[model samples]
Target: MTSHQLTAGICSRLNEPEHSDELLSSTPIVQILSVKRVGSTNGPNPIDRYRIIVSDGEHFLQSMLATQLNHFVDDGKINKNTICRLDKFTCNMVQEKRLLIVLAVTVLEQSTTKIGSPVGLQNPPGDAVASPATAQQTPAANALSTTSTAPAVSSSTTTTPAAVRGQGARSGRGPNIFPIEGLSPYQNNWTIRARVTNKSEIKTWSNQRGEGKLFNVTFMDESGEIRGTAFNMVADALYDKLEEGKVYFISKAKVNLAKKQFNNVANEYELGLEKNTEVEECRDSSNFPVVRYNFIDLAKLQDMAKDALCDVIAIVKEIGDATEFTSKFGKTSLKRELTVVDRSGFSVRLTLWAKNAEKFTHTDQPVVALKGVKVGDFGGRNLTMTSSSSLEVNPDIPESHALRGWFDAGGNSENFQSHTNAFSGGGAVAFNRAEMMSLEEVKVKELGGSDKTDYFSTKATVMHLKPENIAYPACPTQGCSKKVFDQHDGWRCEKCDRSFEKPEYRYASTTVTAGCASADPVSSRYMISMAVSDYSGQAWFQGFNDLGEVLFKRPANELVAIRDRDEAKFTKLVEDVTGQQFNFSCRAKQDTYNETTRTRYGVQKILPLDYAEEARHLMELLAAPWAQ
Candidate 1:
């Protein structure tokens, strides 16, 4: 490459912000001197940062290769003596050193010879050094420096303007302060002053690889937010050092691609704390934002897709007792449900799990604010707090205060529509707290014809029952409900890969009963198919174990024993359930088999007739038109 091809003194000139437009239009070419990788390769998503020394033929400056341009180095197209034009880049000052972040480049020429003798740029002699207070505050300045002591020059020495106006600055802490939104795997030797909006408890996990503990914290600044995670020993050391709602000057953390499945932060990159990571609590946190939320109204949850994460603020209208349940993996966990209402005159069920469920004791209808809560569409629309979620009670934010005042005035006594039930007009009632629909209306509306399943409630009387194939033997394991087959010597559950002396009885579904032809039964559980009738029409519905327990008033095992002992008594017991009316919440979906298609209605919940509540609901409906 010719000496004239390289722009001499361009390395120093690029640091000045005023000449950005001129330089960008000119597209100055430079020669690559060396490239080195920084940071460890061990992490969920390994960091691949490249530090390159580029020369303008007169002065060589340390620059960073943007992750988007890694292919240039990996492909060996940009090596020593390779000439490239700086198409787009940003100049950031770190520890009184100019660091150029190359965003876009165009390879110009490749050669095996040096263009010119270039020397590293140095600060002017006799410049005042940074004071001890400033040096102590900027930890990254020392941590990332190659020398034992970095010579920090005074602000007036060169005055490197930030490439992005108002995006980068030198804080009082002395290091280049970067916005959380701007931090990526490409940049290094930078610090961020952000508030720790939320922190999680240390959680341990055991897998085939090994067992280790980890915790996460969400950090936010005015620009944006990012999630930080520390693992094992690092987690233990920093969990207490970082407190929620406190601002800190964090540095030396590895930045990696954000795992969207585990992270809900808006930033594209996340932080991983290594052993050398530094976290210094900032005493002057008044200027930092506490927490930011993009809250969605409770009424809008009905339209959100299942398992979508959202933020919400509401008042705790009712709280349910904590309940314990064993997961399919046999791990026991606790969960509590809360009925929360907001100013939109809508209520939703929010479920808290594990520690959050155990620690909740608020009972004064305090306003609650939640971030990253997952939406559920089981019985109806609901919300669930996962490990990544942040929950606050009676938060000090303006929205929380406004909600508290509204509830104290007249909102507390106001009738709120619930997400659990479908609404109509000003005041309309359903049969079982859900949208009431007749069998004829359900068919006319083609409820189950669509791609999505439809749910509704109706009042109907049992007309007939399917007596055969009512129950099956299930796996005896606490959480394993798969059907078990009799193996003569022992019962076997193919799914669990284990055999037992006997199997536990569980109500069987029609789907499961079809598979029983290949296996012998051991014990029996409730799985009932019944024909139900109303004034509009009759429909066939399937009720599983729980719904059967409510209708039969006896366990499946007991019913099976009675059938074997006295056929007449079993027949009478089955007949007694006929002609009894109940409110049924049903889910209707289209099922296809052997080229045949039909709508299958499955009972979700069975509620006994509440005559008093039903009468009140009717009265409200009758008065709605008059009031209107």
Candidate 2:
């Protein structure tokens, strides 16, 4: 490499907007003097950012590498003494210093020695450097100039607020458009030009502190993406203005630490819209980037733990009819189940809730891309879309187009393996047959001792039942099973805000239970604690309504009535099931109460002894070479 290969003094020319077109017409090549990692690794955004000192042969300037281009640094493609062409970049003033944001670069050649004796650019003679206070008074300096005629302000020259505002207005953007990846709580007077990729419905919440409404929207630029939220009055004002896939110039919003539990955007900082926040739609947004997804294959879902969030793109193999169900809290909700398959030859059920469920009408096997869908383990493995999740039907992305092509060309005829068990959690144990554990093996292996819950199956005989507190008087509401207070006149349910003449009796579980899906408003249920033992050891397990019915062959309400009217019959009923053996699907979870941590086992499903299946399994085991 020689000095002539570098674009000498191009760094100085970038500061002068009058030469933007001339510079844009020809690519500027520069030498990488050095590269250094910046940003806090312990911060909410732990991703590494690189800052490089690039030389135009005559003068050296500090440049920040766009996060999207970090691969160049990591892959050693661009390094010290390497010459590269600056494909796209912008100049910005930060804290009274000129900073170059390198958006795109192309590596040309590598050299072992420096190409030129480049000196650092200093303020021109007699020019006054802007003070920190003066810097704060101006708009962000990263905004790209729309035209070559836009006046340029040197970082060393102090300008009045009016002039800075005028320049921004003349450029048609309120301020310099900051990249979403560069946003932080420390920056002030910065604006971002980005497209809204997704918007959520306004959600209202009530708690001890009162009630408020809020909504979230995801914004994406060429650099990266971030989540923005508006609350209460602000939410009401901006909810209608931020439409999906529209570009806008947003300013005056506060950047805060992201709440990782609520969102899946890669960026670490999120924006909070305030009353004074400015959001102006940009009509000329043809250059804005569309939504990006980090999709995972369906076959890999088995390796992911429950409650993990993932992005996926697959063909809609089947769609179930929308069904209405009352939630445990008495809210009526609608849901639809979708069987989606990918080229990985695996299928998983994707559940859409509320409006998304009711509005889906696609039947032509459209390719759907979902971001932030949660993985579940209710039966085996499934997916559920939450408030932060976004869905696109027949997206134009390369992945979607590839999946569509594959499906149309005989991929639909391929048999895909399902992750879920068809009969699991309904009336029998999982048909997939989870790893069977003995009571003693479960204890020895320390299952459910971790932060996440552990599930397994076992065969155990019922030993005894804890007779006390087996049933409680519950509200008669269709969905609510909360305990009701018996006033002398009537049963009162605080949650329902109503009173009834009589409280319905229900079996009480120590832990939360799902609501019944049956049509009957008032059905008998049970929540009981029973001891079960296998050949190895004995352990206590919590049984809910379904398990209770399977074990006792009767409803909890009848047992409670029998216990009250005839103690002898209830005692006999309990004793009759004591020695019965069955297959149990159970979950173990550790909980802390009063600083005491203990593991609790809950029965998720129960299955009777299948003599024929058992015999076949035994025969297969005996025929094994090791057994022979």
Task: Write down the lDDT of every candidate, Cα atoms only.
Answer: 0.69, 0.71
Off by over 4 Å in 2: 2-4, 14-26, 38-47, 119-168, 171-175, 303-309, 325-332, 376-378, 420-628
How close is every model to the real structure, measured as TM-score?
Answer: 0.46, 0.59
Clashes per prediction? Answer: 1, 2
Residues 7-62, model 2: lDDT tens digits: 86797776542333345446789999987654322221235567777888787776
Q: What would you estimate as the lDDT of candidate 2?
A: 0.71
Q: Which stretches in model 1 have alpha-carbon errors above 4 Å?
A: 1-174, 420-628
In model 2, state the lDDT of residue 227: 84
Give the best candidate by lDDT.
2
Task: Estimate the TM-score for candidate 1.
Answer: 0.46
